[model samples]
Target: MKVLIVGGAARLGPHVIRALEGEHTLRVTDIVPVETQHEFQQVDIASPAEVHGAAEGIDAIVNCSVEREGRRRAAFDVNSRGCYNMMRAAVSHGISRVINTGPHFTIQGNTYTTFDYEINPDVPPHPSTNPYALSKGVGQEICKVFTENHDVHVLTYLFYEFRDHNNPTLRGDHPFAISWRDAAEAIRLGLEVDLATLPSRCEAFNIHADLPHQRFSNEKNKRLLGFTPQDRLEAMWQRR
Candidate 1:
């Protein structure tokens, strides 16, 4: 299958590119050009022309771009509007599936002062607290709109506690810490699943690896995509 990864030159995007490149035809794109071994394209996802151009003949798209600011304007443009542009392009070109990333901060209303709240994929999303979370919330809404209006299969994953490969300090002890490899696999799993059989109109899952204090239940992912992480941070630390 052919896949277009937006912001593919970014840190986590590179990891996802590597994981998918071996098995699928990959077209990597970013707002700015970067050196990479994969097929690269330069396109601003915020522009409909660029998105439509880049999405031509692609099978799927992974919405990985995030523009974070203290306010909602820029973030909304990139996260929400940018995602709409990509979905429009994908549908126009006959793409079948789209996988989008939503941030854990969307659950801020559930755990404002503490990080101890348990999460489940089926739980209703609470109110967003900040601009970043608001953008993600809007993005998820856009995904649903595409699915309902366009008849496109869209899956969203609430990515939590993203691990920074180059910076150990950025790694958290939270139970939602998904390994880079596992996160990539989750995308692959979501991409392969048949959406027509799903019982719901829209599907969202919490992307997390096994943690002793896991706040979110991954049962939905398992039931829908048979997705389960192959590695855990505790096991990696034990090896060290």
Candidate 2:
């Protein structure tokens, strides 16, 4: 597979790259230069023209590009419109597989619930009435439209708080954490899952560590993507 990683070389990009290494051919793109050995092209995903041009001959697109938080207009422009542009480019270029990165807030409330609960990925998002959430919500909508109207396979992974797992500490069992290894493994599943086996054309999955969260469930994602999370915060913390 010839995969193009949007926002490659960003915070999580290198982890993803390491996971996919030796398994697939790779290309990268971002507004900034990628300081890696992989081939990269300068691209701003907000521009349809830029994305489409770079999208040609690509087998899959992993959209990891995100606008900085607190920039209202920039968030909408880059996150919302950028998602639309990626799907549109995929449709035009005959690229059928896409992996889009999103946030857990798309399904869970920004304010953590006091009680433990499980949230399926299909649950309707209740975004706080804010630009960041609203923009991401709109981006999910765009992914839906593209996958339904066009013959495309889209994987939207909604990740929670992620960090390196060295000597991990728990925030009183908050139940939302994805270690770097777990995150990269989830991305690997997104890249390799068979489209014919999916329940829908466009699907979103909540990807986090295997914490016994009372508020979130990754069971559906496990069935859909064949993922079994390797990092358990408590287990790793004890080892440390």
Candidate 3:
């Protein structure tokens, strides 16, 4: 498959590229230049023309773009408008599958934060007025709308904390954390899953390691995308 990765210069981009390389042809794009062996395109996803142009001849798109902090306008432009451009490009290019990524708080906001266990992705989004979470929630909604109206199928992967699998440091005991390797693997699965097997045109999955806290659930990810996170991150919870 030929894949287009938007925001390919960001933190998560390299891990995703490493996971998909050699198996699929990749066209990596970012607002800045990306030094990669695969096809590179300088794309500012906020611009529909640039996004559409970068998507040409691509079989699928993985949107790793995010604007976590900046002025409110800039945040909305990149997180919200960028997602709109991505879906529009997918529609124009006749692409059916897109893997969109964002923080898990897009779904698990203030309301759900009080709860302790089995919080699933299907719950209503609360986002709690935090600019980053709100913008990202809007982006996920855009992807959902596009899937509902078009032939596209969008798989949204929501994550929380990310740890390095090699060194495996436990910065905090956040129940919703996953190793970078595990996160990348989940994206790979999302990209390859058969659209026909999905329960809806738009589905969101919470991606994380199998932590013992039981605060969040990954059962949907396992059942649908066949994602079984390899990193248990036992050091975070276990006593030496």
Give me the candidate number with maximum TM-score. 3
> Arrange candidates by lDDT, highest first: which order?
3, 2, 1
Overall local distance difference test of candidate 1: 0.77
lDDT of each residue in 87-202, candidate 2, tens digit only: 99999999999999877775565543433377777776665556777888789888998988999988888886776767445444556677887888898888888999998998
Worst 10 residues of 2 by lDDT: 107-116
Q: What is the lDDT of residue 161 in candidate 2?
A: 76
lDDT of 3 by residue, 87-152 (tens): 999999999999999998887887887864799999987775778988999999999999989999
Q: How far does residue 185 in candidate 2 sit from its true spot (Å)?
A: 1.1
Candidate 1, residue 210: CA error in Å?
1.2
Q: lDDT of candidate 2 vs native? A: 0.82
- Model 2's C-alpha root-mean-square deviation from the true structure amounts to 2.3
Query: What's the true lDDT of residue 35 in model 2?
Result: 82
For candidate 1, the TM-score is 0.88
TM-score of 3: 0.97
**For model 1, which pairs clash?**
119-215, 119-216
Models 1 onward score TM values of: 0.88, 0.92, 0.97
